[model samples]
Target chain A: MLLCLLGSYFFYGWWDWRFMTLILFSTILDYSIGLKLTDTEAPKTRKRLLLSSVIINLGILGFFKYFNFFIDSFREMLLTVGVEASMSELNIILPVGISFYTFQSMSYTIDLYRKKIPVERDFLRFATYISFFPQLVAGPIVRAKDFLPQLQRTITFDWNRFNSGLSLVLWGFFKKVVVADSLAPFVDLCFEAPETFSSIHLMLGVIFYSFQIYCDFSGYSDIAIGLARILGFDFPENFKTPYFSKNFSEFWTRWHITLSSWLRDYLYISLGGNRHGTFFTYRNLMITMLLGGLWHGASWVFVFWGFLHGMYLVVQRLIEQPFRSLMTKLRVPTILSAAMSIAVVYFFTCFAWIFFRAPDFEIASTVITRIASLEGFHPSTIISKFMALKGILLIGVLLIIELTNFRIHYIPLLVRKPAFRLAAFALILWAIAFFGTFGANAFIYFQF
Target chain B: MKQQIFSRVGWAVLFVFVVFIGDRAGGWLCQQIVKGSGFRYSRMYTDKAKCDILLLGNSRGLGFYQPTIEEITGKKTFNLSYNGMTMDLGKVLVEDYLERYPAPERLVIDVTMCDRSSPEILASFVPYIADSDRLKGLIRDTSYNVAAATSVSHLYRYNSEIFQRALYYSNGKSDNEWLLDRAMSTSTLKHTENQKYRIDARFIKELKATIEYAESKGTEVELVMTPYYPPFAKVVRGLDIFHEDIERGTGRRVRDYSYAIEDPSCFGDFQHLNKKGSKLYMQQLKADGVL
Candidate 1:
């Protein structure tokens, strides 16, 4: 565990050494707060302790990540109102993994204050859990309650776990470099000059992005989880075939499982959840998602992405009964209905991604408006048939994996069968070498 | 448990073996087809005898009409440039050309922006690199040392998008033309000024060295600064500095035609000329007494 903490620190230090001090400060503060909260049963003391955790973690996060963003937005607002503002933006580097560790560490103190988890007196164990390098920067956001117990027990090397974990790591690498990187140039072309491209190309770009983000993020999660499994520390699965989800509610549960769960247990449930009347229920839902979106980055576009998803959820809920009855009334076969539902859910998810991806609402709205207003039967003239086919091939791989993953344990099973496993790895290797555009980009979610 | 572990390990070893074999086999086949392709540019890179009057640069040189230049100049001219070719790579090729064949009467060097850090020549002439020791040294200074070391057997050199290029060439997709000449509005072709426009020290050094090397072999080297749309005038930087540096480095005046053309129809894109544009530009060159 001591070795793990040092390794994690070293891993993080590589990106920016100065940020290590910030992580160290966060660790000590959270650990101290947890200890203090445990010693005092007084309501006010506990409340103050939790508030300190919130303020300190959130304060650090805000200053590093959102300070410049807020200042710039305010400057823009001032300009709009014809008021002169002269505050210059800072050259602050957002400490990598600041959001992930801050949230993970904050959860420990929160859980302790809520009396849900026992006070972890062992500082080494808690520190290790918070700073575990595999998921430190981009995470499954491992819960202290889940991880602390695992830390207590002696971990042994189980072959099944190791093989399964190895399989995931390989699969993750394939998804990231081969699939994501290959499609990136095309997506960048469309986004860089949204007006230059036809409406068909715009649609292709959005569809490509939905897969790109999922593959990019989920690929990171798979590697993290796989590495943890090999190390004999189990991190929860981060993604579970999100595009296969039938509704926005199901999509949330499947996509970024840890973040969604974190929001629900900590924020939404705390805000009276669904126990309250419909008004507050919807408000809580909106606020939870809005905050969740803001958690991704400091940008208003991300907040809008969250807003769109929130709206999707609220509307889906209102119409779930009607939609269900309508499905019944149509008398479509079960498989057919399920397919339609997944398609519908995936379409809305792709629509929201424009907001997530676009630099601002204007660009996002332009893309959407162009998509809607497009006339004539013009297919994409810019993208070649070969390039279009490649996109379809990559997206098809994900579809096959998810659809197959629903039934069989695809990655693990491939691992067990040596010939098939080796062949898969070889295929991934070839794809990466030949198809992947050189210059491996950093994981997309690492910024968050 | 022991049996299960042993069996699994056995298969893993076998898989690695197969992948190694596949990579080598695939690389060798791709290398052969690329060399054997009907594309004349690929042949010009290593060919000894085509050094009469050479045209050299990146895509700017590749896009130049060699047939028209030969007709006008009455000297054998072939474009020795490929897309993504760098100044240093051009220097190496020039030196190699002088070594293997008689020096050309004139080497018309298109002095395009020397900003790209990596040269695509490493991937383009993998087999030629393997066939010669001197050819291998050219890439060592660039970011190909690590790649070259691993690719000693020339397997890793074939790791890029070469298979597709080879397939396209073999399938006769290598059109002997550059610009699409597609009907695009001048509004669409309006160039945005790039913020970053600076030359690398190494690129300038090699470019100067290339001039000196050619001059030593009695080959007169002339530089032509490719024309861009007037709107992108602000984006093209360091031409004056580049000119001064060349004169200081090699004592030769660079014949800059950066503002030579202005008709919107004469341009195919922001920087490049279409076939029609190039034909007119060739006549402009003869008329202006610049060539």
Candidate 2:
């Protein structure tokens, strides 16, 4: 426990040693709060302690991540009314993984306040749980209930665990270095100057970006989960082919599952969830999603991305039944109906991703306008057909592997069968060498 | 625990063995595809592209437009140009061309190819590395990590935009028509407010070496700046400086056609000319005795 705790701190402290104090502060605060909640029979005191924990964790997160954001926004508001206000924005380097660790720390106190989980008394064990190196940065946001017990169990080196973890890590690296990074230059080029590119180029850029963010974030989660497994811990899956989701609700469930579930459990339910009337349920959903979006970054673009998704969910609820009935009446086969639904979900998701990726509203609007105009949509107009072709080939490879894995569950086979294990591992290593973009390219979620 | 450890180590060794076999097999297949490819570089290396004139540049060099040049001058032409090609790769290709084929009558180069150098583009020349020691050395010097990667996994040498083009032009597909076929979009024209390109001394040295080598082989080397849109040409910075540097470095007068084409319809983009533009430019080149 001490070794893991020190190693985790060292891993984080490597970036900025000053930020180590922040992690240490949060760990100590939560550890004390957890124990206090357990000892106190008084409900009031326990609630206050929990509140204190929440305040300090979020307080730290906000000051580092969103202080300049709020100030700049306020200044912008004042400017709109012709009341010129000058606000000095601080140059704050947001410590990497602050959001993930803060949420993970908060979940422990929140669950303890509800008496859903026992308070961990071991300081080192609790600290290790908070700072576990693998998921410490960009997380699956493992809860105390799920992770604390694993700390209690004996951590033996098992071959089965090693094999499965190795495969997962290999697959994750392929998605990240090969697929995501290969798409990055083209996406960056198009986004850097949307007006310069043809309509087909901008459209392809948006599509490539959607997959880039997906592969990037999910690839980190996979590596984190696999690393944890190799060390005798289990992390809940974070993504499940989210683009294949049939509806907005299903998309939320599939994409960033941990963070969405965290919001659903803590924020949405606390805001008088769907048990209330439809209007309030919609309100709760909007608030939760908007917060979720803001949770990603300090930008209004992220909030607008959240707003679009919130509207999608509300609008989908109102029309889904009628749409399904219409499809049934039209005698659409089940496969075709499913295909249509997936396409709709993916298309809207890609649309929202345009806002998420764009530097600001103007660039996003330019991209959308150019794509909508359909000027120079011919193949010959694409500036870099080589890049476009490479992106397509990589995406094709990813889809084939994912679709095949969906049917066969080859992950377990990669663990159980020697021949399968050898082939799969060797192929992944070869693919990484052949196609991987080798640079110190950090995972996209590392900023969050 | 001991048995599990041994089994794991045993599997790891077996994995390495399998990977080695697969890499060699995959690399051989790719080499065959490359040799059989009608892609310009493949044709150059395979001795299928001996001609009276050689054209070299980045994508801008493609404006030399082989089909029109062939028709106008009635001389066999081969373009040794690739998109985003750096000077390092350009020199290697030129030197290799000089070594493999009898000296062509003339070699036309777009001096703007020295504007930028890209390691990624140099790395893309990995598939042709086996054919030239100069290419292997240049790639090693510029991007040693990529060179190491190619050595580790031979299949990696074949993974690039260059190789992808090879596959596209494989099985006897002609690559003579490889040019940007689009006309200028209004947005592109609007966005081409002043732009500057820096010419590195090192790249100029590479260009000088290439020019000297072609000249030594009794090949008349003509360095020219391709035509840009008139509007774009008005605001372009550093071309006079680049021209001066190229002229001083190579001791050859660069035929300046940067503002030669006034018709915007001829331009594909600010940096390149469409087929119409290339045709018009070719006529100018012929009239000026630069063809």
Candidate 3:
């Protein structure tokens, strides 16, 4: 266990050696607090212990990640109000994996204080839980409850499990290198000069970005889960086909499943939840999502991205039953209705993605305004942008594969056929060499 | 359990082995296209080139380096223009060429208003600069980690367009960077007023140094503004300012050729000339004693 913790630290140190200290600091604080929680029965002492974990973990995250952002914004605000307040922005490098590890570490004390999980007596087991490298940096944000019990059980490597894990890793690589990276340069060009592009190119940029972020992030999650499986563990799925959701609420439930569930179980229900009627519920929803946005990055654009989502959820909540009834009254076929709903949800989600992608609110507004005030609708511009994205045909293939994935019940190998498994892997390997975009592009979610 | 694990591992290894053979085939195919004269640098560096009039600039330079110019001038010529080849890359190419090859008698730069360098352009040239310490350092100075990896990784090191040429378009051979006969525009082109051409001081300084270096080596350096479609040429931002800077910096007048052609069918895109346009351009060059 100690060796595993060392290996995890080494994996992190590969990026920057200095960041290992930050992870250690987080682990020690939470570990000590968790032990204190178990030792004490007094409510006041237990509350203080939990607060310490919250303050220390969140404090480190905010200081490293958000200090410069807030400082710059404040100075800009002061200037706008006819006051000169200028200070040099601090030179602070946000440690890679700081946010992910901190959140995973803090969950220990939070869950312990709530008496939802036992305080771990074995320090090595707890330490290993904190810095398990596979999902450490970009995570499914594995909980202590899910991971700790697995540590106690005997880990036996199943041959079938090994094949699936390896296969999952390959699929993740295909999604990331072939699909996401191929789309990145095109999407990047549009966002960099939103004004330069016509509305057609800008629309393609946003729509393409929706797929890029999905494939990029989900690809990372798949790799992480696959790696964990090789070590004899399992993680919950991070993404389903999120773009296929009929409404915003269903979208949340499908996308980033662990983070969504974490926010619901920890942030939402803890804040009096929906039990406190519509007004408070909306307030809570907004707060949770705004913080969720801030969790992504320290930018106001992210906060606004979260704000749009919060609004969508509230509006979706209001219209949920009515939309269902309206659909029933219309008596359109179920498949047609589903297709229509998916189209509506996907287009709106693409609208939200503009803000998510834009570096600032100004650019976001520019993209939105330009899109609304369309001068020319040229299919040629859209086609040219797709041509620039060399692997656009692969997107159609990927979509077909995704749509058929679960429904294809008679897939050879996966139901214990070794030859088919090998064939599948061989085919993917061939595809990777021929179609993959060759680059070591940093994962998008790694910024958080 | 151990036997099962070993078998799974064996299949994985076999899969990779097969893919490696496929990669070899793909790479060999790329070699065929990349070896063709359509890719200018590959031909220039490899073929015995009698370099007397050397053309250097960005994509504009490529379009302006008329194939007929060589015949008209009775001098062997090569176009060193690259797509998005900014003043940054241009300067390095200039120094690198002087160090390695015999200096040309005349260096004609097909000037554009703005030249912006990016890591993408720098990275694309990584494999080409494997033996040059100064070039490796220049790339590293732009971006430390990404440049370091880009220089080393086989997957990232190779240029893709040239690679694609070898695979799909090797058979379509051309003697120059562009197919002059193909008059085409892929999309509607327009000039937006808000799009200002921002100048980099470093690029200007580099341009000055490059001209000085060429002049020191007895190579006459001339900057030329190639012909643009009349409507587009009228609104090129900092067009006058760019000319003033080049002339003012180098103390050499920028020979003006822009807006020389009136025929609409001669133009390809907003900036470039079709074969018909090039024929007219060649006649003008000869009349002006530029050829």
Candidate 4:
């Protein structure tokens, strides 16, 4: 994992060489602390060491990620005071995947101290478990309990698994190159410079961006999983037809599955979960989700994003009886109800993504204001340029595919019929190779 | 276990065979349609050796250069420009044309700074020559055309509809029809201006290679910077350092026609020429003995 991170750091030119040295230092410290925590058999000493590790890791994360944000807010407060002061704006480069791996390592030590899982005897395997290349940069945030066992076993090659993995990788490449990258130009044109575009264009850009991000991140996860599968490992599924989710709760269950489940088991449940009472349960849910949002980045936009999801869950809980009664009164079909719930969830998610996609709060506000204005109603140009007919057809195709066989398991089955499967593969490859807009764009979540 | 393994292997092999056959059939069908059509430019440069002159560059080259240079010089000519083509492509196109056709008597290249400097564009041509089938399959499949259809913002802002219409109308044409359209289109040609002059070493190197290839073939090479609007023209004109760098890198003289004549009425847009402007520009080129 260390070697791979170093290699990726060099390959992608993501950060300066100094950052790589900092990462090495941090890793060595983490290892020594992990060893010391597991060295003792006494429950009190082990708990103390584990607690110290958590504090140290969280302290490092909070300082590097949130120090500037907090300082700026303080500076604003200081301006009202008689003494005017200014601090240099620290241009700190947050280490890639620090939030993810720190949580992962902390979970390991916490689990060991609690006697939930045994400490790994082999340090190399333990490190590998923490920094597995497939999920190192952007992750499923593999848990020690889940991933460590897989590392302990010797790997063997399987042809069936190899073919399935190869297919998945190719599928991921097509989704990224053909669907996501192609959408990027229009999305960037609208989002990066929204002032020049109309409200309609802004809306379309957001819609395209929503799809672009989904395909880009999920496509990356698929490739990662496929790669690991080829190497005789089983990483957990990260996405599961998230767009087709019926509600916000379901969406959380489906999208970024590993992160969602991790937060649920480790954070939400630990914070009194639903055990403390209804009001406390709501508080726990809100706090856990808001922190999860902050975990994405040290910005207010992420806070809003998390808060929106938390709001959704809270509202759902609050109106559970009323919503059920309304559904019953409407005589809405099961499918219709599901569709409406999905649409509402999707709309709210898209609204939140505006914050995720925006450069800052000001721009996000501008987008909302502009979208509300609906200033120019020029449909002809958009319809003509976007080839309205073909665009609709493509969307129809995607929708059908998503609706019919949204599960990953179906992908392998669909490809089992040799002739049709091969033809589909060829077509997808040709489309990606010829139609893909070749740009130097990494996956959107690479920043996270 | 052995049988299970054998079955999986058999299935994989069958899959590959099916794909290979499908791609070949698809290519043959597209070729047949293209050949049997009344398309004007499709078959004109199908074999390069027969052509007398060749024009190379990106969309600017395609949209600006008049193939009438062949008629004016009483030689067969073809524009080998592809849309969004880069300097790297300019190099490959030249090499490919020379290999396929006799060295032309003259070669005209349209130069752009952005296209020249982009590494992505440079990397595109690597697979074209190295993996011929991969490229051939891409073009044959018309996936770009499909993508162009689905992309709304690309169409409205970029005016790709004009190109698409032209492509559609040219469908199903014979070689004779193509030549006739070429002749008819030449008279109404316009000259446009070049904007955003940015230069890279790779573009300069490619331009130098094109010049060398032309000299080797006993052909004359003229590097033309087409006209642009006044403001953009000023920008291009201000690229003296970039121009000097190109000259130093290429070891060749490049003609600057960006400011040769600036009449606002001649422009269709900021950088493109009207029909009258193109004819006037061509006349100027003829007078300068650069045609």
lDDT of 2 by residue, A1-448 (tens): 6777889989999988999988889999999999989999799998899899999899999999999999999999999999899789999999988999899999999999999999999999999998999999899899999999999998898878987887788888889999999899899988888888889989999999988998999998889998888888899999998888899999999999999999999999999999899999999999999999999999999999999999999999999999999999999999999999999999999999999999899989989999999999988888788888888889998988787876578767655799887877888888887777777778989988
- Using lDDT as the measure, the top candidate is 2
TM-scores of the candidates are 0.85, 0.96, 0.78, 0.69
Clashing pairs in 2: none
Model 4, span B241-276: residue lDDT tens: 655676678776667776765776665544555555
lDDT of 3 by residue, A1-448 (tens): 5666889988999989988888878878888888889999999999988888899889999999999989999998999999998688899998887888888888888899999999898888888898899898888888999999988888886766776777778888888987888788878877886765667778877877888899899999989988888778888889887877988888998899888888888898889889989999998898888888899998998998889889888888888789889989999889988888889889888888899999988788878886776734565435233235454576787788778764563542453576676667766765665556665689999998
Candidate 2 interface RMS: 1.5
Please tell me which predicted candidate would have the highest TM-score against the true structure.
2
- Lowest lDDT block of 10, candidate 2 chain B: B185-194
Candidate 2, residues B104-184, lDDT tens digits: the string is 999999989998988888888899999999999999998999889888889999888888889999987879986767678
lDDT of 3 by residue, B1-36 (tens): 699669767877876775566555544554444555
CAPRI quality level assigned to candidate 1 from its DockQ score: acceptable
Interface RMSD of each: 3.9, 1.5, 5.4, 12.8
Residue A383 deviation, candidate 3, in Å? Answer: 9.6
**TM-score ranking, best first:** 2, 1, 3, 4
CAPRI quality level assigned to candidate 3 from its DockQ score: incorrect
lDDT, each prediction: 0.76, 0.89, 0.75, 0.65
Flag the better candidate by TM-score, 1 or 2: 2
Poorest 10 consecutive residues by lDDT, candidate 3 chain A:
A380-389
